[model samples]
Target chain A: MLKVRVIPTLLWKNFGLVKGVGFDSWRRVGPVLPTIKVYNSREVDELILVDITASIEGHIPDHESVSDFSHECFVPLTVGGGIFNLSQITSLLRAGADKVSLNSALFENPGLVNDAAGQFGVQCVIVSIDAHRTERGSYTCFSHSGTRNTNREPLAWAKEMEDRGAGEILLTSVEHDGTMNGYDLELIERVASRVNIPVIASGGAGNYQDMIDAVTKAGAAAVAAASIFHFTEMTPLGAKDAMHEAGIPIRRRFEM
Target chain B: MKVALINYGMGNLGSVRRALEDLGANVIIAEHPLMLLDANRLVLPGVGSFGAGMERLRNGGWIEALYQQVIEHHKPILGICLGMQMLSGLSEENGLHEGLNFIPGKVLRLDKLGCSLRIPHVGWNEVNYREGMGLFNKIPQAMDFYFVHSYAVVVEDPADVSATTSYGTTVTSAISRHNIFGTQFHPEKSSKSGKQILKNFLDYTPC
Candidate 1:
């Protein structure tokens, strides 16, 4: 059986890794290289790096920067933010990223995702969905750094992304983001039930129990945390230990 | 200790570089033909279409020198993923594309099997050693390795197969003929088992 992955989400702003409460107020922690080194040392199964500022500057991820991470990253790494074409995907993968994620580009042109997956393998492609709840409590898809709203239903988009050859879906609920009030269980359950590929529940992780509940109840294939880890409130190893103690089957970093 | 990783301009060589360096080997990303001269061993890392990789190597003038060095010098040569597939003579994928022809048998698109099993077999699977190859001497037979590809090499002669793993049917996972060793999986991304496999190749004595 494939082991459940525990990932720490890192944000890249101006080529530096940062962590924040939701999307704003990002604090520069360290360079991406050292941050990856730290995560690799912890025996983390995987890492997710999103370039939060790439879209604003109209710049794609710097291949050399990604190469630095892949050169040192001991585990699988997924990078997202500002990838729009087949050439960009090729550049990202060639530079060492195991997977390149897209969100805005998917809505702009749907064919790119499938085309990329066809040329490369599906395992190298991922779709990130940023969803937020309306006043009526209906989940709506958001794009362009969550500034623009698409009328498409959240669950509907999840299925579409999977059908478009996304190996995994990075689903983040805007309403629950950084709240730590527990995941929007309804949103997670809705998407996870519909999609065949793994769904990583991102945003609003407060405690170890929340992570556990997200996987067990919400059916999230993986759980991503930022504030808790960035603030040192919970370390990746600590969360994994807590989960293991709670009877969740997770891979451990065995000392060689 | 300068290890030359052949840049055919097709596959994932960066991860392989890091993996080798972790084993204390100084790795050099060598794309030019002369770069191979300064290195001790050669690693041919490949991904994407096998034919394109061969064409790139040929156009770059590295292919001729690569064949000359690995064939005559008896230096360690590790072909990873598609690099492994390129070693064979022919492939059924994207029309009949000619390979390096080092290993016999035509590479066939796994989709032809028509099994419900997903193509580009992703994630981890085990490799069962059928032959007594010292490269995997102490390694368990069913140890899982990360795989991501759609086409597999089908040997005309089974003796060249070092190991086999099943996706729908048992397919060749590793093959070796003299100094040439090819792995269909990426050892760099494959955790501890992968590290050991790389170590075994580094320590193996060539005839």
Candidate 2:
């Protein structure tokens, strides 16, 4: 049985970690290295470290920083933000990133996903989609760290990404981001049902029930949390234990 | 133990190299085939399509050198993920591509095997291997390891399979025959159980 992954997402900006509601990302958390080291022993299945400002500033990923983080990240590390071309992907891979996530670059050139999937295998190419509910009540994809509206619907965009060979999709509902309310179960179910590839549910997780809901109700293969971990006493293990108690197949043993 | 992680212009070598070094084993990131001669054991780590990986290995002149070091010299070698697939005889990914033939087998797509489950089997899954011997010594049976790949090896001989895992189907998760060892999972990225498996590999000695 495949274990449902519990991933701790560290949002990086201006040298430290931050949490924001709906992608504002203004509040300060702490450094990146220590968070990763702690997660290493915390029974989490994977770690996703995204430099929140890299793509918005039109800069490349900080290879040195990623290398340092990955050095300490014993579990599989997925690095995202500011990854545009093949060279950047190569640099990150050599820097120890098992996977790279693309957001803004995918809006500019959707073929980057195809090219990346072609060059570096689809398993390493993860396309991050930030979806916001429009005034009319339909969700539209947002880019530039959830700044600009790409005018593309989440369901259609997710299907296209899957067709383009993206191994996984990091689906985030911007309105629910940092709210600690719960995952956008409707949006997650919409996109996850549309694609055969695994969908990682992100944004709006308040407690262990929220994480379990993302997997049980929303059909997410994995659940990624930020504010719930930073703001509350909730740990990744606690979330996994809750899910495991609910009869969800999750990796409980960190070590022997 | 001297362990050389092969870099054929593919995959990430940092995590594997660091994992070995953390265990107090002398490690080398070998970009050339000649470097394999210096190490007591070779660690072939890669992440990519089967066709592209084999092309690089052949062009880089790694096939012959690997055969000499791992086959003739009997120096134990462990192949990880795509590295494990390349040890097989052929792969059907992006058309049929020939492998190193280190382990006589063919790589086939998991989805094509009537699996309703998603393609590119990603995430942690249990590996059913015999414990307390050779590669899996000290590691618990049916341990979970991280895996990310669409294809798996089907060896001609069933005894070549040292471990197996079920994900809508029985995928060959690990293979061990004589001195050749291959794992479809990423032990370096598999948390503590993986680190223990690597330690066992470092301690492995051929008869």
Candidate 3:
């Protein structure tokens, strides 16, 4: 059985970990490598490191940091933020990243998705959509770390990305981000139901039940959270225990 | 033992190198075909389209060297992910392209397996092994390994398949034919189970 991935999304800014509310007002968490090492020890299914300031700063992902982090880590590592070209993707992969996530660059040049997927297999390409529900109740996609909003609808954009060779969709709710209330279940269901590829639900996970809700109700293939794992004492193992109790198929650590 | 990690300009070579080194094996990135001559074992690691991978191997003048080492010298070789797919007879990804044909099989898309499972089939899944396969020697039964691929190998000979996994259907996850071995999952990223599998490969003595 394919297990539902429980991922810890660590946001990096100026060489340290940080978390933002609604994608703004960032607060420093700690050094990047130590947090990763913590997650490494906890046996988190996967780790996603996003350089929150990379796109606004107009540079590619810091491959050196990624290389250093991945060397000490064993689980699959995915790096996103400021990946704009195929060469950048190549650099991250060479630096030990298993996959690369695209955001702003994907909107600027949607063709890059096809090109990257062509150069590297589609499995290596991931499209992240940051969405916020509008006043009219319809969701709109945002780019550039949720600073700029696009005219495209989230559902339609997700389908287009899948067709353009995105192997997976990282669907994040801008409104639900950093709030820790719960996932935007409606948003997740809307996109996951439309795309054939796997959908990773991000943002608004206050507790284990929120994670469970994302998978059971929203149809998410994976559930990711930063605040719950970073701020609270709750560990990935506890979350897995909850999911396991809830009857969601998950990979557990092998007892020696 | 010295392991030559083949680099044909794709895949996560760093992780594989680290994983092998952690198991106390001397790992070398074999950029040129001649590097394979100095190593006791060979590892073909790749991440890309089958057509391009085959073209790079051919253009880099690696096919002949690989054949000499794997087939003639009978050096144990392990193929990972795209490397595993390349071992098949042919693949339909990006058009019909020929494979290394070391193992009698063809690579087909997971969706074509006639199941409604999602494409790419990402995440960790359990692998059920056949008895007497050396790779799973100490590894637990139905252990989980990290996987991220859309295509899987369909071996012509049932005897060649060493392990199987299910998604929407039963898919061939591992194949072994004499000195040639292949795994569709990334053992380098599979944590303890993966480490054990690599250790098993390092300890394997080919007949």
Shares of reference contacts reproduced by the candidates, in order, are: 0.39, 0.74, 0.61
Task: Name the regions of candidate 3 deviating beyond 4 angstroms.
Answer: B92-97, B111-116
Interface C-alpha RMSD per candidate, 1 decimal: 2.8, 1.6, 1.8
Model number with the top DockQ: 2
Docking verdict class for candidate 2: medium
TM per candidate comes to 0.87, 0.93, 0.92
Compared to the true structure, candidate 3 yields what TM-score?
Answer: 0.92
Lowest lDDT sum, 10 consecutive residues, model 2 chain A, at A247-256
Error of 1 at B167 (Å): 3.5
Q: List model 3 lDDT by residue over A140-239, tens digit each.
A: 9999999998878999999999999998899999999999999999999999999988899999999999999999999999999999887898889899
Model 2 C-alpha lDDT per residue in residues A1-256, reported as the tens digit of each score: 8889999999999799988898984799998889888888786799999988998898866999999888888798999988889899988988988899998888779999899888777888999999999888899999989989899999999999989989899999999999999999999999999998889999999999999899999899999998888988989989988998998999748454
Better of 1 and 2 by DockQ: 2
Cα misplacement distance, residue A118 of candidate 1 (Å): 4.0
The true-versus-predicted C-alpha distance at residue A65 of model 1, in Å, is 1.7
Candidate order (lDDT): 3, 2, 1
Q: How do the residues A111-206 of candidate 1 rate in per-residue lDDT, one tens digit apiece?
A: 888998887778888888889889998888888777778788878888887888888889988767766777777888889999988888888888
Interface C-alpha root-mean-square deviation of candidate 2: 1.6
Model 2 error, position A7 (Å)? 1.0
